[model samples]
Target: MHPALIPEKHPMCGKYMEALVQCRKDNRFSRYIGACNDITYDLSLCLVKEKKIARADRQAQWHDQWRKKKEEDEARMLALKEQAAMSKSESPKEVSSEMQQL
Candidate 1:
């Protein structure tokens, strides 16, 4: 296969891509009989590896963001609970003061 036909998504496989291209050029006739098979296989494997690494990094980042959002939500809920508790504690004094006046 021509190097130009290869996808550009895997920078890590550039060397493998070059090797395959060279093999094809060196064995223009033999290439039709599997002369570049090994190079092509190696390039495919490298691309697969790069893809897996990228997916893992993306997953880790997503998990970190999700954990941070959950932590912030918990803190906000705790703050609201504390605010409610404080208001409840102050209500009885206000009610008693009103009763005394009545």
Candidate 2:
């Protein structure tokens, strides 16, 4: 495979992949006899590491979204409570005026 093509498919393990590909090309006959085993192993390790990093990034993003949503909900609840309190405080005065008018 072309070096450019390998990077496009495995961005994180591109170098390792390309090295293995080159090794195989250099030892075409021995490659089938394990000449490129070390490079293959290294490529697998790189893929695993990249996958772990991706998972951690996704989790962090989800946590941030959850925190923002919780903050918004708390703010909304506080505003509603303040509105309820204001209405409660004003209702008695209006009731007293109505009683006096009667």
Candidate 3:
């Protein structure tokens, strides 16, 4: 899930569902398996209800090229910073060498 999506208020639903599934698989008895299946179905319905709660993405990305452009821009900015730092360090050495030549 995207970071922007609101976290579930009841996070234990998935765990509960998993446990129900496992119990149903291990138990051959009809009553227990039927009970697990019913509970799982109810949990599924409740989880589905969350989709109806309207929410907006905090970090919006409407365009198709947005991700690619963002990545490229970050990479370019980093490269530029590195290049500038390298040039700054090399300049002092070059200046000293020129002074020696004179």
Candidate 4:
């Protein structure tokens, strides 16, 4: 058997190596390099890349949500201002003119 296929003193090494080979075959060189350097291949640089991608996705989602909330808040404030202006108007004619200006 290939040295890479051999189990370390434990049964889990075989499974781990198989996964590592697959990672290499998949062109995930960062993971392969990590596996090559680490004894158990459990703490690889691939994980860092994965985490970075996940974090970026989360940040993008948060930014989108924040933008939507900001738009909603602006809309709410505008509505409140309009309502207040209408309420403060001295006459119905003034209210119509103000609404048209808006």
Candidate 5:
């Protein structure tokens, strides 16, 4: 997107970046550059499944989508944990803090 991404959340990006760098170091930069479509396609498929959108329109949208997806997922997980805690006679806050550590 902006040549910056949270690698931990985008495993495909990290994988692609590693391959791109290796290609460049191996004097195959032109090959990777020429395969931009393949890169976008691969990333798009992965990101789409994560409820994110990555396209040529703009980079900020991609970042926003990713951030939104991440927050939604975390909230859903917290809600589930709270529900489980409620059934187990445990504190929601304590369960929530434990979920954060994970």
Candidate 6:
């Protein structure tokens, strides 16, 4: 499995659906094949539900990281602008002469 694609843990953590499927596959309830099939179907539904929850959690984390980085960048830009403004105020004549020279 690709490292990025691999789930950190079984997607069905805390879910009993896998155990139900395994019991059916193992023929634990041999007397009723219909019951086994029903259990398997239920397991499939649980798996889908767990996967959706995991996917949403991962997306939320990704967006949070992006938001934090964006905020840091904006703060840095504002600091730089403030520093430039302060320096310009302290040396207005020099800056004006330099602009004329340019």
The number of the candidate with the highest lDDT is 2
**Candidate 2 regions with alpha-carbon error over 4 angstroms:** 1-8, 11-48
Listed per candidate, the RMSD to the true structure in angstroms reads 4.3, 4.8, 10.7, 12.2, 19.3, 7.3
The residue-by-residue lDDT of candidate 4 on 1-102, one tens digit each, is 224344453353456666656666665566545544443345344444545777999999999999999999999999999998877775788878899999
Score each candidate by Cα lDDT: 0.85, 0.86, 0.63, 0.64, 0.66, 0.68
Error of 2 at 99 (Å): 0.9
| lDDT by residue for model 3 (1-102), tens | 112212255463655555665676777687453756666666666566544332224234335368889999999999999999999999999999999999
* Candidate 1 structure, TM-score to reference: 0.58
Candidate 5: tens digits of C-alpha lDDT, residues 1-92: 42444557776567765554555466555664564556546655666654444354467777889999999999999999999878877677
lDDT of 6 by residue, 1-102 (tens): 111222335555334445554665678668275656665565557667777988999999999999999999999999999999988887988888899999
Please provide, for model 1 over 1-102, each residue's C-alpha lDDT reduced to its tens digit, 9 standing for 90 to 100: 334535465578878887887898899899999988988888778877887999999999999999999999999999999999999999999999999999
Per-residue CA lDDT of candidate 2, range 1-102, in tens?
A: 223436777788988888987997899899988898898888878888877988999999999999999999999999999999999999999999999999
Q: Between the candidate structures 1 and 6, which one is better when assessed by TM-score? A: 1
Report lDDT (Cα) of residue 93, candidate 2: 94
Badly placed stretches (over 4 Å) of model 4 are 1-44, 91-102
Sort by TM-score, best first.
Answer: 1, 2, 4, 6, 3, 5
Where's the lowest-lDDT run of ten residues in candidate 3? Answer: 1-10
